[model samples]
Structure formats: C-alpha cells, structure tokens
Target chain A: MPKLIDFKLILTNIPDLLQYLPITLGIVLLSMVVGLVLALGIALVRLHKIPVLNQIFTVLVSFVRGTPLLVQLYLSYYGVPIALRYWNYYNHTNFNINHVPAFLFVFVAFAINEAAYNSENIRGALLSVDDGEIEAAETLGMTGWQILRRITIPEALVVALPTLGNQFISLIKGTSLAFVAGVIEMTAEGQIIAGRTFRYFEVYLSLAIIYWALTVITEILIRLIEKRINRFRVAQHLVGTPAPTETPIVGAQVLASKEVRS
Target chain B: MITIEHLAKKFDDHQIFSDINLEIQTGEIIGIIGPSGSGKSTLLRCLNLLETPDAGTITIDDQQIVAPHITKAQRLKFRQASTMVFQQFNLFRQKNAWENVAEGLITVKKIPKDEAKARALQELDRVGLAPYANFYPEQLSGGQKQRVAIARSLATDAKLLLLDEPTSALDLELVGEVLQTLKQVVLDHPNFTVILVSHELGFVQEVASRVLFFDDGRIQEAGTPDEVLVHPQHERTKQFLARFATQTVHN
Candidate 1:
C-alpha cells in the first residue's frame, strides 16, 4: 500500500479519472438503455413462454449466465474479427478486423450480458404478479398486451425496480470489464495511469474506492426512492384512511397510508 | 341475451357436461342450482367463452361467441357483454378496488381515463363501496371484496352477470350483505341479466326470477320458484328443495 503512494501521481490521475467519468457513465448509460430494451423483449418472450421463443430465451439466458463476463468480452473482441472474415470473403468487401472499434465490442458484449441478467430480473417480476390481478384484468376486457402494460408491467416495475437498480450499479462496476476490451473507461484509464506512474497500489485503490462509493450511493438512492414511493402515495383508498387504519375487513395491516393519495 | 345449443364441455377424458341447452332471455335472472359435482360452472363459463365447449355454440346478445372455428377476437367481443364473478372474488391483488373496476372499461371499451375512473366510482357506489374504491382486494373483507368484484362487472356496463356461487365463500352474516348489494342493484337496474349458481335457496328465490334444479350434470327441472321449489316435478328437485327448505329454516 505504501510503495506506490506518490501524492503527485495520485493527484494528476484523480483529475484524469474524473475526465474519464463521462466515458464510464456514458457506456453504463448507453448499455443499460439498449440492454433493458432487449431485456424487455426477452422477458416478454419468456413470460408468454411460447414454445420456440421460450426455448430461445432459455438457451440465451443459460449461456450468458453460465459463462464468465471476462470471457464474453474477450470472445466478442477477438472472435468477431474471425467471424467478419467470413463476411469479407462472401461479400468481396474489405472488412478490416481493426476497423471494428473496441468500444463497439465492449458495448455489444455488455448489452448482451446486461440483457441476460435483466431479463431474468424482469421475468421474475412478471411472474410475481398475482394471477388474480391478471384474471381481474381479463374480466375488465383488457387485451393480453394491455394487461401486460397497465397492471402487469407497472406492478412488476414496482417490484423489479430495486433489482434493476442493483443491476445498474453492478453494471457501472461491470464497466471495469470494458478495460479488457480496450474501451477507455474509468477503471482502464486508472490502469494506464498506474502502469505509467508506477503507482499501481494507489491507482487500483482509487478505482476500488470509487466503485465502493458508487455502490453505496446507489444503495442510498434506491432506499430513498423506495421511501418516496411509499410516502408520495399510499394505496388509492389508503389516502386519509388514518394511522393504524381501521383493521381492514380481513383483519390484517394492509399498507394503508390513506392520507397520501396519488 | 344469451342462447346455448347442445353445449358440452369435457376436461380431457372426463365429460364435465353434455347435451345442455338453455335460452337466457334478455333481462332475466336465472338461478342455476346444483350439487358439488354438477357442471353449473362449466355451463356459465361456456356462455362467456371463458371455457370453450367441446361441442355446441353459444350466442350472446345475438352474436355467436362459440361456433365452429370462431376467431378469438370475435369471442372476446362477446365476453365484454358478460362478466363472470367468481365465488372467491378474484380481484387483482396489485390494483386497488377502483382500478379493478375501471380495468375492463378502459381496456376493452377504450373508455377515457377520467371517464373510466368516474364510472368505476359510480359502480363501486352502486355496490356501497364508494369509499373502498382505492382499496386493494387484500385489504377488503370477504364481503367487501365480493362487492368490489360485483362492482368490476358492473363498471364494464355488461348486461349479463354470471355469479359462480357468488356468496359461497362468505360466512353466514357476510353472505346476506353481498346478496343484498346484488338485490339492490337488481331492483335499481333494468335490462340487466343475472345467472347465479348457489346452494342457498332463499337467496335464489330472493334474486332469481326463475330457477333451474340441476342434478348430476344436467338440468332436471326448470321453472319459477313456485313451480320448482313449491311444486317440483322432478324427484331430484324435490330432494334439493327439501334440503334447502330445512337449511333456510335453521339458518
């Protein structure tokens, strides 16, 4: 810990790390957005549990979940080049392996990985939706799609949000993996600075510290959101219903914050 | 508003019901009575296309909901007119009572949000649950929940309501409150149809304009309560009535 502690090198790299913050955040943001969209599609496919599509998602989820993240990144970065040679051979076009940017491989790999994990998160959320609720929606004449959007998805979002938040924070940390693919993110930029300045311990310690700080921030943010959602609105009828509300007819304490009505 | 012709439903190898035919006139309240194993539920579900008949056709409000190779979209259109209220009152757990009520209106009828909410409140009020509008089903009592279920059906503006033993799940005192809600609604709303399956004869007599005595898997006798309960023709009808009459007296 003491050998690599040059105050000057650490100070210079701290600013550099801050500069790379956008690159790190940008990748996290971009991959998460694209990954979530794909995840929704995959989640839907799994939810409907159609014969072919369910099988596809099953295989896809298992495959992504089974392999290590590092390997997935390495395969995308190294393997895509060989695959494109086939494209080049067939199309008679000059498809240089080098032209395939490092960022693209990293993004694609991250997106795929995020989608796999998020799909499982979302699918579990969808399943947790009460069957009675869906049946009630059915009686209301809600189409299958409408039920998913109106009651099923929104309710699932309440359940899925926390898990998704965790994934997102992990995803930001997962951006560290992007360093392997040569995409210049905060973790990687830290690595480059550490190697150059021979202050390996300080640089890595800084990276670990930032990641830990981020995790803590996300945890606090998620907890705040959970509280806000609870505070901002109780069950629709819960509004003004009163504290230690009338023992509901069924004789259970049902989250009755009646004063707060959406 | 509904017609059933030679309708039959079989669950795999077991024939649940067969050779059932009935004409439900517009605005008629018919109570379907039967024992535990009887196919009263299967019949009600068939009318709404919630359970497809193995053989036969159901025409509701002059539209065929079940026919040879009918499209699901067309069948769903018929479901809009008839809502089935379950014995356990399967209100959506995620939604509050009002969302449960407004769901069909907004989703199937494409009613606007404000309009749907307004209508849902009105229906809940109709069932004496205006205050419980925003309450989730889990929060409501067995009686309150059933009223919400009834309100959900009413909110859709469905002309026909199918109660599959609507009050069977409630306790002695609770049952009357739900039945009273239904009775009040019946008195106030004209051009509404109700087909109920129940073991409670007094309730059947109170709400059903006519009653059918079912035994095994078929309708053994069909007539007004005076005819079926008071002057029954079938042995099974007589048997059911004797039990019902005694139970009513004791309860």
Candidate 2:
C-alpha cells in the first residue's frame, strides 16, 4: 500500500496554506468586534430584565445558542435574504439581496453565535461585582452611569477577561465554519488544495499544524494581556511589605496612659 | 442636623422597622447596639435613602424626603448629604487608597483633580495611611482598608457619616488601630455627625456621646452611654447588655 502520509509534501504545503491565515484572522477579528458590542447590549437588556425587549432577546439568544453553527450559517445564507426580500416588498422599499455581499452572511452567522455565548460571560461577570461596592459608590454619591463606568465595568472586566479571551480564541477556530457560506477561508482553501494535489494526508497534516500554531500563539498573547491587566492584584499578595504609618497628630503629644484595645 | 420621623420599612410580609424616630445633632456620636437582624443597618441605610423607607420623612439640614414620594432630585440631594462606611470596608477594590478617597470629590463635588488629590492625601495622612496611599485594598490589612474607608467618608465632608460595624471584620490587633483612628476623627471633625453601629461595648462607651439599644425592631433605650450601657432600664435591654457582657468576658 502507498504511504499513508507523505512527510515531504506536508513540509512543501506549509507555505501555501499559511497564506490563508489572513482570511481566517480577518473573519475572526471582524466577528469578535461586532459580536462583543452586540453582546453588551444583549447582556444589559437581560440583566435589567427590561419589560419586553429582554424576553425578545431571551428567545433570540436561546435560538442561536441551541442550534448548530452550521445550521445557523445556512439560515443566515439562505433565510436572511428571503426575509429581507419580503421585508422590502411589504415596506415598498427598493432593496435587493444581491446588494448584500455573500461573505456578509458568514460574518452575521459567526457574530450572532459569538454574541449568544459572550453575553452570558459579560452578564455573569457584571453580576459577580460585590453588592457592597455598588453600595459604596452610591454612598459616595456617584450617579448610576458613573458607577458603571468607573467601578462596575472595570471590576467586571477583570473578572470577565480570561473567559472572554477563551471565547475569542474559540471564535477564531469557529471561523472555519465560514466555508459553509462559500467563503474561501483557511479550511476552505485547504480543501481546494488537497483536492487538486490528491495528497490528502499531507495537506490535512499541514492544516492541523497551522491551526495548532494559531491556537498556541493566541493563548500566549492572551496570557500576556491578562498579566498586564491584573498587575495590581499581583502586587497585592506580596508579603512583608511593612505598612508605613503616618505621624501622630501632636508632635509632642504623649500617648494615652491607658491603651484601649477593646 | 438629621431628623427621621415615622420611618418604616418592610420586606414582603416581614416588617424590618416601623415608626422609627430619631434626631441627631451635629457632632453627636451615637452608638447603635443590637442583636443580629435588628434592622440597625437598615435604619442607617434609610437616612441616606440607600434603602428607601416604606413610610417616613428624612430631613438632612433642610432637604426632606417622604417615603414612596421622594423625587430623584431629592434622593440625590439626600444621598449627597451623608456617607456610609460599610462593615466590609467597601473601598473600591480596583482603586488604590488615594483614588478611593478622591473619587467622590472629583466626580460628585466636581473638585479639580489636583485639589482633590491633595485633599485625598491629607485625608490618608489623617487616617495614618499616608505611606500606603498607593496600595490596593487587597494589599492592605483589614484595619488599613477600614481606615481608608473612614478617610473616604471624611473627605466627602458629608454632614452625617454612618458606620456599620467598622471593626467587626478586623483582627483583634487591627481593631485597636481602627478604633484609635475613629476616636481621632470624632475629636478632630467636631462638626461632622456620626452614627456608629457596633458590638464593642467598651469602645462605644469610650467614644459615643449617646447609645441606642435596639430590640424588637425598635429603639428600646436611648440615653447617654452611662445610662444605657451602665444603667439599663428595659428588661430586654438588660438581657441584651448582660449577654454582651458575658461574651466580652469570655473573649
């Protein structure tokens, strides 16, 4: 039988596949930015338990989270245009589905999927902020938005960072699903190269190595960011740093004869 | 001056406190002592509208808010009039000591950054935390954190300051330092009124001008510490004092 894997071809295919990295990175970065913004709104709506909008978001997030990403891609690709066409016809607008770029469907599908998961992360992080801190801010006479901006969001972001980094990395891998929408991203390009070369084992091996490297690189960068963000916390746990005391009020005031330690 | 009249609060079917009336003069240090779940903290909270009373009128200086009828403007005005020091020493965890002290000044009172920083540093110095001003809350001992909390309250220059169990969360060694700082605060800032909720009868007797003994969701006894702490009138008050006395002796 022929060799199950051709090691030479795997080495040669590495550069050809590496070029597709930008396509994967582009989709992931765009989806992350859009997804994070939308997630904030969605998280707030549910957190405040707004009258009706919260329930609508509940259904939307549930649908996206419950279904498979591939199915979501199909729905975005096929379903969104039909819905938009009906929307245009009924509203008497001259909009056309052809005007929407095909790749936009992939972006929408991945972005919405990431939003569904990240909203929970954001919401949980915000909720984890101590009730005492919120009370402290209020007692300090800080307005609600000021407290959110200064106290709540900063503390919550610290709590949410690692989880958010994990979600972003997952989203990077998730971009491989973009091939479902006919987007020529990394995995899609790999498939085309493999079909032409008939060296499936070598091409597939190269693809795996590229993805492994991407995951490892993303993890290292995220760790560095986390360390920078939590630098204060790092200093907090160091021991033997003597607490320096300010001088007593009276330069010549004698200590009280009776020390009240009760 | 602070006045609370016919104050009431209820959580669903459980009544927390009702018809609570109090009058505090400027510079008065009133100690509140009670068993757990006596609504002492809630009473303090209602003064600043932190926990809106179901029925009552709270007046600080001239701004008065009636329960269930307070406007947002009135709420803000009332909240601005007082500051609270929590048992947890709820210094903003993300901020260092100076920022925690200066945040209210810069954001609420619109003080200039340079001026607020100077004032914050002075307050930190007052609390004997000058050198630790750059440290985060988690870096400081519980006593240091409480001192920072006290400094933050003092820096706001609020007419009334409420402290809920300031030393209850501290180590035995730490409690003495915090109590000393508090005594200094009362002596130095004679114009600032204080309501301290505490379990340390010795400290309360030493520092407070008056003591209020809370029981059954009401102030059963209110008198000079000599009367309330030394010469209790009500049977419940005597029982409560007796229990605290034994606990202290055992400790």
Isolated chain A: TM-score per model? 0.81, 0.85
> Candidate 1 — which pairs collide?
A133-B92, A140-B104, A237-B134, A238-A258, A239-A258, A240-A258, A240-A259
List runs of model 2 lying over 4 Å from the truth.
A1-20, A195-200, A235-262, B71-73, B110-115
lDDT of 1 at B249: 80
For candidate 2, what is the interface RMSD?
6.1
What's the DockQ of model 2?
Answer: 0.41
lDDT of 1 by residue, A1-262 (tens): 5643665655566777877888888888888999998998999888777889899889988999999999999999988888899888999989788877888898889899999999999989888887766766666667778878887887777788998998999898889989888898898888888778777877877777777887898899888877754432344453224333344422323334423323
Q: Compose the digit string of candidate 2's lDDT tens values, residues B1-251.
A: 88889999998998999889999887899999999999998998888778889998888888888897888777777898899988999888888788899999999999998999899989998998777777778777888999999999999898788989999998898999999999998889888889999998999999899999998789999999999999999999999989988887898
The window of 10 residues in a row where model 2 chain A has the poorest summed lDDT is A251-260
